[model samples]
Structure formats: structure tokens, C-alpha cells
Target: MSDPIEAAIFEKLAKADPKNVGGKSIEPADVAKELQPEQWQRMLPKVKATALGLMRQGKLTITKKGKVVDPNNFRGVIRLRLPTEAETAAALAALPPVESSDDDFD
Candidate 1:
């Protein structure tokens, strides 16, 4: 149920080898370019936001120098890749606990 751009980003990453296997990660520009070959530059911010959303969902990983970086606080060049098994586990663990509403008890 993802939008076209989000779908494109996932499709691109799904095709790339996981970074744990010596696969070269992709930059936001790469997805942006694929989504809009001519005006790809205009797509950078959207691409980045989508990537961050994916990472937060534990479906993706954002890394710098081969180490995962906090999605909320990152800068400079970064690479995107499908999260490895361990990364997925860690991401799931790092997620904030959800609280149920009191009304749910009714």
C-alpha cells in the first residue's frame, strides 16, 4: 500500500545485495535518479524522507562508513540498504514501547 515513490525506493533496495554480503549500498540520489531521471535533484528531499521512514519501520537501514546511524540524527554522505537479520532485530528492539489506551479495557 505504498505510494509510487515509496514503492520505487523499496523496489530498488530489494534488488540490491545486502550490505553484509559485500554489496555496495545506494545513495538517496540513486533512488531519486531512478524515480525521476531528468529532475532527479528535485527528488532528493522526498527520497531521503521516504528512506528515513523505511528505516524507522525496520525495513531499511541507513549507514555511514559501514555503521548504522540514527535516522533522526544523520548528516553527510549516507548509504541505504535492506537491513540484515541482526539489524532488523536491533531495530525492532530499539523501537519505543507502545502504550494502550485506557479505553481499550472497556
Candidate 2:
């Protein structure tokens, strides 16, 4: 990915597992830290957007309070993680195309 924020988010998620994230889902702050440890807050929006892009692509899922939330319009705190194969496909099918070009990822 060309976007450093997206790459950082994926890098952290890629390490998700019992031994990595303690089986816990990742938050935008986590990816922000990877991108700019000294100022993670500034990276929050980009990280969140990247998470949304991944969700739209069937690679990630967004959740709030342990329940899946709509990727396009979720409010409040959110967590990110890889989705099950079926969930991924279903989520991808349910959403309309928010992105135009393949290179237009957030």
C-alpha cells in the first residue's frame, strides 16, 4: 500500500493473534502509535479511514462494544480485526462502492 497509515494499520493487524495482540482487537490508537508514536492522536482519523477501507475490501471488520458496526457510518469507539471468511464476503457484498479507483484507498 502507498499510504503509510494504511500500511501501518495492516502491519499491526497482520500480527494479530494470541501471541501478538493477546487475541484482543486493535484500535485506531494502536495503529497511530505505529505510525507516529510521539503524536498518535494526529493520526487517528487516517488510521480510522484506513480501517474502513480494509473493511470495505473484505479484509477487516469494525466493531463497537463487541458488535459489528456499519463501516460507513459508525460512531463512538471502534475496534478492528480480520473477519471470518464468510463474514468478509458478506460484509463486502452488503456495502456499496465507496471507493472509486483501486488507488484511491484512504
Candidate 3:
């Protein structure tokens, strides 16, 4: 199971406009404000952490200066967006090869 905040972050990023169309990207603060309008300031850190988690899972992208940055090493400002098709392919390719089970023969 995943945290609710993480899920919300993914949902928001997924619905955001494509970079090629409108060049839309979401700041962590934007999500924090949307999820917690009253205490948005307090939610910023949590929102950023959740966004990073999603990025690590290959379901999201974190960019700095319009280019993807290492999720493990970035600072200052960042934007969250759904991974481009090329990025998605690269991420999928980088995954460990799956092992087949004997049950598949049944």
C-alpha cells in the first residue's frame, strides 16, 4: 500500500498538461496548496517527499531547468511532470529482468 499523499501527488502530475503542448509542470508547493489549502505551508515538505517517491518509482519526473535531474541529487527548484514517452521506455528498460515461474507452464 502507498501513502495517500503520494497517491495524490501522482494523480495530480498525471493530469497535468504535457510539456510539448503547454509546457506545464507542477511545483511541490502547488500540490501542497491544493491538498491543504489552510495549512499549505506545513504540507510543503511532505508534498516534496511524496513527489520524490513517485519519481523514484518511474511514474513521475522531476526536472530542473526543463531537463530531467537525478532524483537523488537535486536542489533549489524542481518541477514534477509525467515522464515523457522516451523516459518511460528508458525506465522500463532499466528495470531488472523478471524471472519466470514454473506456474506459467500450467
By lDDT, the best candidate is 1
Q: On lDDT, who's better, 1 or 3?
A: 1
lDDT per residue (tens digit) for residues 1-106 in model 1: 5577778776776677544463457888988999899999999889888888888878888999999998879998888887878878887888899997778555
RMSD of each: 2.8, 6.6, 3.6
For model 1, the local distance difference test gives: 0.82
**Which parts of model 3 are misplaced by more than 4 Å?**
18-23, 92-106
User: How much lDDT does each candidate structure score?
Assistant: 0.82, 0.80, 0.76
Task: Provide TM-scores for the models.
Answer: 0.80, 0.76, 0.70
Sum up the clashes in candidate 2: 0
Per-residue lDDT over 35-70 for candidate 3, one digit per residue giving the tens place of the 0 to 100 score: 899999899889888777667667777889999987
Q: Write the number of the candidate with greater TM-score, choosing between 1 and 2.
A: 1
Q: Is candidate 2 or candidate 3 better by lDDT?
A: 2
Of the candidates numbered 2 and 3, which has the greater TM-score value?
A: 2
Q: Residues 9-65, candidate 2, lDDT per residue (tens digit)?
A: 767777766454333588888888878899889989888887888888888778899
- The candidate scoring highest on TM-score is 1
